[model samples]
Target: MTVFLIWSCSGKNASEISNETLLIVKKIEKINVLMGSAVGSSGHKPNQYENFEELKKNASKQELITLTNHSNGVVRCYSFWALALSENIDLFSIIKDHINDDTQVKTQFGCSGSTEKVGDFFINLVNPKDEDSDITKLTPDEFNKLDSLLIHKENNLYARYDAIANAVPTAYLYSKVREMVVKHNNQNALITLSKYKNPHDIELILKNRDPDEDGESGYFYTYKAIQNFPDPIFLPFLEKKLNETLDNDRYDGEWLQLYMAIASYKNQKSLELLTIPFTKVKHQDIKKYHIKFVYEAIIVNKSKLYDDLLWKIWQDENIITQEGFEYLLQLNKTKTLELSKKELNSNYQIKNTNTIPKINQSMFSQNLEENMLNFVLLNDKVFAYNVINDKIINTNVNDFEMYCSKILELKDPSFTEILFKRLKNEDNPHVYLQIVETLISFKDESINKRILETRKKNKNMNQDWGSEALDEILKKNKIK
Candidate 1:
């Protein structure tokens, strides 16, 4: 008891401590001491406690009220639950006022609700009666106060949002919520109104769905609203945008969301519209977007109609990458692999012609040299600077391994500097290890000296995967 008192007093003077503050300090001290005792008894932390009921029963109403305002959010949250269990009416106003505190509190499971807003949690505890019923528990004055807060434009966005969301179950302030949705076109208000299945809210969202002068569009939320309501009336607007995107040869960034919204209908008309863009679009970007969404839609709806279309897309060398092929394989492995074999044989043909095919270079050339080096290393390929073609060509192949095999197969000394540079600056430990392992296979005394120097430089610093990699290489080679 004295240890607890001394620890609490050390932080703040007894003269400055209020009765409310002292109560919280004492409660925390008791909990800590109890935890210590439990640890001592069991030699392990106790998950369940036998004294939890006693602890709650002992809490005074006044002290609980005071604890709600405590600097420690966990203490405040515990006080909230205790007051709720005790059915203390006084807690209502205090909980409502502190709804926006935003202090993180931990659950009984020890995970913190850092991402959750406190106001949302407080509103859930209120549990007002259903929409048609009269306010059963709250006084008329308190009920009116909640209604005012729900539509108060000046209040915190989350606070007002929570009020509207919670008010839905009780149907409290329904008219005011509709009015806010229409008048303000507020995103949160629209979301709430959509939940109630109001047709008018859909029209409002479409009417207000224009991009700003800065080309910033709220179509993401607009698409979300349309998905919630799922009205056929909105299909023309969506189709028109899709057509515009196709015509302009550029994406509006919300293309994926729009495509998904269209596919959500799962109807002949919507499916037909979705297939139009996929079949007719030659633009690789548009093709990629369609492939991704179409595959997702097929998986979601379990539709077999798009199987042939996905296979066709997978065969298109310009549209699919190694990663995309892997993803397609996951969706349907047998069909994907069968298609991939045919496509790979044709695409990877080593031609003697000096004419390089006009492919989209931007995709492969962004990190040109680095990407080329990676291709050569990982794909067991070689590049030659063809002066006539004015492009690099894949010239040879060897077995792919990280260590001795890769180093022994390197016919070009030009790549050695590139490998060393990558090894020196590479931050990823696994990659660093691969490079060190490859360099070790060279068995060059000069390279070994450099490796040892690097080891010495990083030795006194933090031991990471990079340092561990160096140790493995040194151990394997029997080097000091």
Candidate 2:
């Protein structure tokens, strides 16, 4: 074990450990951080749920693989499950054996969700197999270990929790987790969570503890015992949310605690009530949240149900407004991008050259290029640029640079003219600096004209928007 640990730990700094080991370390360190241990004694104050984030950033691909094979079954199980979350089947050949992709059912969670079964995921990778066995397959014994952890009462809380999550891989897990809450005697814990005033918590309590069920006090009492222990009882809560998004049914989970109470307890009829007032939800912000999840619930239909909300939002004088665009951007990027494309293209159906809404088309045309660019800008770019660490920042800075370069590559006469116009006086140093940085990514000297013009403007103005903004832009441009 010592030799193997040393071998896996080689070819790495404390900074560059593989993701598998890093995840294991993260799990252990999270416990340490929670326990206020000396292990993370660098004066770092761990955020409630964020302590493992940095270790996740520093972990490598192979280290994650190694951690999956850790000597401790608990460690192996934890890392095995993490891979299911972070990776698709393609990341490692081993996943292919568990997930056949052809035989799985279309669960409420996603399309062909059966083929991407979480049970198959953990079952295949949990304990691995004979030294001579194929990488794509695992033995029956290996699969059982994962199952036993969930169905068997002997396994610890973490193992049972992760196992059940792997087992159902659906809103069905809600029932299983509820069962576990009882098995684990978590009632007092649950009651405490319910008493909390926050909506997200009250939402969670009402979600996991259904009011309609009478005998649940037994289960509730069990859960209350572990209230202060800080187990992630929210797992099934998150799963219920993602799964109830199956369709634009009357009772998808989007209406807060409504879906949890229904789906977690097998009240299939609740789906009907799930979607009431969607069309009638007139408040822009509330309507936006409804449509965001409603769209997900109806994603299987492509745009059949989406068209309803889209048309209503687009046509309603009261509903269709900029306030909802933020919510729309959060739902499905593919659908939103497609909608933007359609609205931009002359041949596309939704375009309104009539200028009915009086959108800011002249300042920035809603062409595909500009719309997509603005979506990224208004959505994630602010957070990405501000995040100093790789974990929160996403690992693809260069890819983002390339993607932004593609936006700059658009040669539309209007778009190009606007680039030069904005570069000359763009007050947002961050946005302007991003433009300069992205322009150079294309490596085309033709853009040099734009840069030169901006520099000329930068010199003559004798400093406009404070020296800090100038300093920022120059820093991004690496200007002398």
Candidate 3:
């Protein structure tokens, strides 16, 4: 679980790399110099943590350059990292050329390899689905180069992979652009790669974005190609592929990409799209795509949207079975809650942290309530929460305890009346415990009622659960 943390250059003094860092770099450089092609283990560098790492923190601009040039591949990788951090535009072309070099080392006389464009490669990795990065930590100049490189052309994966070594955005390297990114400069490269299911080579293209000094993106050709064939076989496969990939951890940013892609889908079909197997997926990120995709479809298809599919999925207990309901609760309140409220049942019980209030106040607040009310629920579930200084806290909300808490919180006597009836009729132990907890939370007054109630609920709850909870609270409060 060792994640690589690379420092990218934006616009800073490349020459200013410090000297203290150079001490370690000098050693690594010597190793590279002495060992040559065999510098790393069997032609590759050792673990990414090269010995030079210790000096990296306080490294000045000059020392950084030396460290970047050290003999090891790990060292060379850091070079890109240092340059990215510098944010100096002048170094970009230089670094770009270095990565663009198709010149492979003479491992065996002359076994040269690809000479792909590195610009597009790096950009693609940063935001695989092309979501913008929060290089805000980067100076203005640093981001400018990234913005400049987003659509730059590249020949193979090396450039992109190396670029990945240079930067790590939260959601870069999207699977959506996997096929397209591989064919950075080649117009019909994607078509060839996908075997013409996506004919015209430039079929589903990104927009006309000129990220280089020339400011000329090949969007027109790609668009014209997609338009060339209104209905292509690849589109269905593309949709299916996206749906299938939702179960994977690799597509961490699938939701963002699809959200953006669907927005641009001038002729997208919601029925077919909604029917896609988002329900069966096991990843949290992928489920998010379903919600996003549906939202986009709703906006575009409107009357044509067959929301019944969503309703069915909403009611499905197993829909979120892949991941836990707690994860579903983590979704942006504005996004899920708003959508949910539109279709959620009255007994919706939230199973996770309600950061929804925070999100509702942010830019995404538009649909807070709508999303919050969407979670599927039952009438008898316990929905109890503890408030410590007005901040609500509910420790256990597994499918076992949500509804009871919700009903217990009601000030009205009618809620209790409903629970009283359900308590007598329902034999589910979890349900009974929930009902009891609500009553206990109710007027901590009624000591006799409380003891009897606690005793009865205790019988139904987990063996030691009620006693343990009371003991812990009493230990803290030291009450009689």
Relative to the true structure, how large is the alpha-carbon lDDT of every model? 0.52, 0.40, 0.40
Q: How many backbone clashes does candidate 2 have?
A: 29
Candidate 3 has what TM-score? Answer: 0.40
User: Is 2 or 3 the stronger prediction by lDDT?
Assistant: 2
RMSD list, candidates in order: 14.4, 16.7, 14.3
The sequence of per-residue lDDT tens digits that candidate 3 reaches over residues 11-95 is 2223433445555555554544211122433465432235434544556555555434433443454444445445443444444
Tell me each candidate's TM-score.
0.44, 0.36, 0.40
List the candidate numbers ranked by TM-score, top first: 1, 3, 2
lDDT of 1: 0.52
lDDT of 3: 0.40
Q: Which whole-number lDDT from 0 to 100 does residue 233 have in model 1? A: 85
- Candidate 1 structure quality by residue, lDDT tens digits, 211-328: 4423434576576666666688889887876666664455555766677677767677777777777667768676666656655554444445554555565565334545444455
After TM-score superposition, what is the CA distance of residue 38 in candidate 2 from its true location, in Å? 13
Q: Candidate 1: where are CA atoms >4 Å away?
A: 1-95, 100-154, 159-177, 195-202, 208-216, 278-302, 317-333, 339-469, 472-480
Highest TM-score against the true fold, candidate: 1
The true-versus-predicted C-alpha distance at residue 395 of model 3, in Å, is: 14
